[model samples]
Target: MPTPATSMNEFLVSLLRVPAVAARDVDDEGRTLVSNDVTGSSQLHEVGPDGTWRRLTDLDGVAAGRYLPGRRAVIVQHDAGGNERGQLSLIDMSEDAGPDVLPPLSPLVHDPAFVHRLAGVRQDRVLYLTNRRNGVDFDLVSRELGTGVETVLYDGGGYVGEVEASPDGHWVVLTRPNAPANSMQLLLVSTLDGQVEELTAWAEHTHQSTPSWLPDSSGFVVSSNAGREFTAVVRFDLDSRAWTSLVADDEHDLVGWVSPSGEHLLVATNDDGAVGVAVHPLDGAGDPRPIDVPPGGCAALNRHPDPVWSASGRALALTFSSPVEPLYAVRYDLASGSLSALRTPGAPAFPPGLVQPESHRVPTPDGEQIPTFVFRPADGGDGSVVLVVHGGPESQSLRQWNPIVAGLVAQGHTVLVPNVRGSTGYGRRWYSLDDVRLRLDSVADLAALHDWLPSLGLDPDRAALYGGSYGGYMVLAGLAFQPARWAAGVDIVGIASLVTFLENTSDYRRSHREREYGSLAADREFLHEASPLTRVEAMRAPLFVIHGANDPRVPLSEAEQIVAALTDRGVPCELRVYADEGHGLAKKANQLDAYPAALAFLAHHLAKGDGVTGTVTNIKEDTE
Candidate 1:
């Protein structure tokens, strides 16, 4: 028989068995095209109205897919070993199509050397973005499904995203990042003449959501934070080239998508971590008519399929992620106003004792109230806490499906999920706090949270830091810069050195990252001082690092250097490298291995042992 701790650990780790379903595209007959991890990796799956669930692809790694026009054939997007070099392919799903595991992927856009992003599938054509022409800048291209004729919609670009195509087939909107940091440039290109129309001045530096085009192609409905504090729904006219407000929220950001019938708008509000969804008429929404969800908080926008509505416009599909629940997809019927979960391989009736994270605003040293979520076990926390930071420095740690946070709470460990200084969703002002030379300011924000941890009954001395990508960098920074604050850390594909990362990262990413992290030519010294690797000698905490071998963004070298240096200094360090992964653990098999090991490692270091709770001091060596 295992000890109580061991049994609890095993049960928490078993939570990984909960399949995460991301339902995106819906066919004409109301069938949903989804990607789920039930088969150990994210693969294409279809959920029908009659309760029929079918897996479409059986690959060694993750895959993306969409239901084409008539469902005769489906577009498949796949890549090998977590390399971001995914290609677009087509699989026949018609009645005449013979069955052969995935129906044999017919090469649609097969260039292994370059990266291709599938824009979307329309009735007549498929649009995508590829850098195959120059290998640096992405060019928007569309291929006619019937004629198989390819046309370049726009060639002038850098970071030109391949996004949704217009319903009228005349225009396809392409996006690119512009200067001043955290803003975008949208270019509407004419499919026939290759003419382009730019929307918004890049100098505005305001973020915008997906432009939901009207069926008549007259204009688009989108949410933007231009000339305002919070993002609100506004319409952009193609004729007048002006924006007219449809809906405005005084406090929170609201994103709206026009329904398929073009009569209603599906609007969702980002109220801190909780999402409130409602439906408004296209003519003009008065008071929001709430579309009821599970109550805690609906999942973020990206969780659902684009457009977020059924082909008939009578139903909306969404994924719900709450502190007490693992992610599950739900379908909302507008006519009946009923919300139900989409059927999958296995859906569990989770126990009631699961903890719900409380939103706490921890005051930073500079008096900035950092938004943090405190998940304390209902039976009183074990005193061992883990401070979990999010990646993106641009992204927010929303109240959503986080298996790690859920597992940590299950194992009786207090988890602090903080949307530190640079996280989005708060406002534009909050996200730019750590930009350029002020990067370390965000790192200092973590120390404040650590010092304030004890007030919540969490043992500050017996705490660990955990994050991935940018958050991974934060984990390393907390250990290196505030050596006396953190007891242990787990870094997953994090940036080790700011200078080297900007230099060696993917070419397409370098310029984009430079906007926020400062340019190599301009601020090399500041970047070096800001890197966790620069203060490696100051690190004294035991660390566990996980990285995907094929990670294109942060790369494997970042993990190797920190692991090698820390271990060379005789400090306790554990490294797990997945040969078939990228930036983060995409495959369930790899996640099962890395996530469990990380939990165990943190648990051991944070266990209530005498003398283990002492603060970590810098490891000083006299090289004479």
Candidate 2:
């Protein structure tokens, strides 16, 4: 047999952010599309309806590009400084031409307070939010494509997010952030007069949210946890002050765009963690008709607006993905309930010899049944396994794409991700079971998986634990709380000391942390008891920590404090901090850099074969 030129290192290159569908026009424009690959490095790949793909841009780090309305050109965001800061660029698709780097609306050197998400385009202008106005805070701004003159809009000091413009271009709707849970407030901003008006007051105990306006502009639709166990969509009667729930799911409901025809509503749901998209009538109690895309595990469903509507109100294009599947854009014909793949993921496919996941129920310490997903090597000849504890002790492990998991699996590691106690989609009781005093319950659920793994013939001694954010905190806690369970631990931006994490977080995040972990000042004893940093000496496994210097949620201090304590005790621990990252790695290059380092660490400490024989190297530097 011809030797496979692909090494374990090269097997994971495709796992990085390879583009599936690029710069797609609202409608098929002569079948013109843009996509990319790993080595091509984010350059636009033009695809035709016939499946022929060609590169349209050679620029390095072409962040994002989409078709411009009323024009034959494609507007793109480009990384000018090679430091992950992007500038707007234009690509004329009318001719077979590459992109042109337009003048930036802001300086390339200044770092953004957070990742920038693009709102819809105005007349030849792009509206975005940046920290230019408040320095420490963000503000809405508009930059004209004709002249590149940036105009600052509302000062986003107060809680403001998800900027949406109303129909007829008359008003702008934004979600205003209030302390505690995110309370949605609808604000109408006049484009002609520049006057702002408050449309609604803070709904009490109501998780506030405002969706897009109906095509008739009769009223705006908002989704919230009101009068329901899970989130539901409601139409707020602007004149009557009445709210009506249009649709509701048992535990998780996500409302997408209202059909342009004003007849149907598309909803994505987390029904016991099996996610799928559903279509329902505007006003009815009938069961919603569901369109099966991918398995809901770790998947996010998004419906596009202004569907082609070849069959009146039924057919449409949608995007879907889970942890196991990469993002894929597909055309769904509601009439036949059939899905056709419009775009497929390039390179970095799932590890070649990994088995498609098999789901099972594991019994938690408290006798609660937890759902678990296991992805093993195809041969199972490799006895080593990795238990990936998900973040959001409140968040469940659904089907989703995780480059880190893919990388380790490429090297013959069986990856197991579990939805423990406190995870959503299970039920209200299971989720709240891990709150505050019950938080240790999540660790117990992991323990159940540890005991259950050996029955599958995998070696427990070769198994390790890895997670980021809340998952990261679990890594340390798993070692501290149950030191004998894991061989090694990789902590990515995880919490070490619950008390310090809450006390030192940004004012914005500090307000929310109280709800999840309890108040640091009021619950000092509980905080100390739950903290991994306070019990670092109990950790016996080799440890690795990666943090973003600019992370505001779990600050760099979280990484520093734990590393300092472990090092002071002469424990084997390694830490890496990136200067320009935040809560998560934003830059694709940075992720590419970090994934390999993590894989090598796991292999060094946990892999049982030749992989552990000096294949892993640790490099550490002083961030201070």
Candidate 3:
């Protein structure tokens, strides 16, 4: 028998060994195609009804597999070095012919500089979104599967949020994001006549997404926050240009799916941070009935545009994970309302009774109650705490399977993750609280959370700030703005300077980021003022910085500039750069190297009586 994990490294090893199903899709034959990390690298794997897993690809990248309509083969989206520029390759499941990159779909196969997203692949045609034209905005394009003829379906500008085709293949719905404001509009395009009709007007602060067509093709269903504080299921009519609210709730955001037959719609709503599923009929006959979801965290049930309804429409597949549970591909039977696990590869081996996080509301000075999750050891902790802030200022800190938090808890440190004012799932007003000039308000909220930790018996002064991307920025901000509050900090691919990040980020993602952060041209002064680099002089805590050299979102320069400044100021700092990764550490090998180093760094600095300071470690570079 394998020995139980006792040390931090051993605990991390056991947790990371648990494979997570990143993306999954089911076919007509009940075979499930999943992209999992069972082989250290996230590759394509097929799971049969007998629960046997067969590896499909051995590539070293993140692969999201989806079976074609006829189930003859699968189309996999693969990206290299953690870059978001994904390419589509068709894999012949029968002959083991490996994955073949379609020439017509990917004209520049050798170049990994652009991003290609598969919208929908039918029998004879493939629709996708690409920024090949200007590298700034994604354009909707389609290619014939047999003849290799590529055609531009929509040449409209701005970021294409989603591209979905009708079941009949005569119409396509495009979701175009209007940035600098958290909103998007839907456009309906006809394939035969090339006519485009705008379904939604350009509205500020109104968010709309996940459009599913009705079986009859007369209209479509979408989740919209228009004229409401939370997202609601709304039905749109093509002929009358009318929108009717199908399901509305003041407290939750409704996200659901309309069956292929158009008889019933399944809507998932965010009850605070947890997911709740409700089924409603399309004919406006009766009240919406609730569908039972498995006890644990549901992966934002309504987040995906395409619902994973089985070919028979009797069952739906969903990916779910909990604080102690590894991600699993589960199937929920519509008729019986029963949820069964289809693939739980690494779950059984994981030790039971891990630390369960407790939800709390930390009140900020501005009268906002931040939703926070605290993970502590059974014996409380060693008094020191590590605050793990999440990215996407717009994203919420959900209860998911996170090895990093578990490892921190194993090391006798209390871990606190907070969903601050800007986090989603609370409501639109809460999400918009940290925009532009008010960005630092969210940072102040973090300070409030730090001040409130003492009430929970955690030592406030002995805390360390940890996060990546935007959260990484928060780490730097926590040290700079509230220097005396934290003992140390760790930032992974975070932004040191907002101005440089916005200017250097990929063109296609610039506007979407600008919507969260301020615009470069319009809010130049405010952007620079909110940057952590501007307040670097106030940073007294020792720091550890980790970044990917190939990071396209927050470039490597963000790490380099901050590290150089901290080192020159005689502040102790450590910098690690991985040449083979991007943004965050995606590959398991890189993660093993980075996360362990992070835990060690925190232990050395934030440990009870470690007062050692002013010793700078030389920059370490990993090319693995």
Best by TM-score: 1
Q: What C-alpha lDDT do the candidate models reach, one value each?
A: 0.79, 0.63, 0.79
Q: Model 3 — which ten-residue stretch has the worst lDDT? A: 101-110
Model 3 per-residue lDDT at 580: 79
Model 2, 55-163: lDDT tens digits are 5566644455555666656665655323333455565555543323322222322343443435556447766665544433656666687787876656646546567
Q: Candidates 1 and 2: which is better by TM-score? A: 1
lDDT of 3 by residue, 1-624 (tens): 112234667777777777777446776565777767766777777777667767777765677756777746777777888787878777666554333422122232223778888787777777877888888878788877678788888887888877778887789998887743567877899988889887767655588887888988888888999899999999988789799999888988887667777888878777656665666887879877765545546654532223476655666777777777777766666778766675545454875547778889998777889889899877677898999998877777777778889888887889998888788888898888898888999899888998898899988878999999999999999898999899999999999999999989888888888977888989999999999999999988999999998898999999998999998898899999998788888787778888888888887787778753859975768766
Which digits, one per residue and each the tens of the lDDT, describe model 1 over residues 1-624?
123777756666667877778766665465777778877888887777776776688876578877677556788888888888879988777643322345656889889899888887876778888888877788888888888899888888688643657778887776678786777776777888888777866666877767778888888887788888888889888789888998888888778888878888888888777887888888873655787666666555634444367666887777677776776667677778776677465565554466677888999878799999888877776798999999887888877767788777777788999999988778878887988888999999999998897798788889899999999999999999999888899998999999999988888788888988999999999999999999999998898888888888998889888888887776788788877788888777777777887888787898887233333222211111
lDDT of 1: 0.79
Model 2: how far residue 484 lies from native, Å: 2.6
Q: What TM-score fits each model? A: 0.94, 0.77, 0.94
On lDDT, who's better, 2 or 3?
3
- Which residue window of length 10 is worst by lDDT in model 1? 615-624
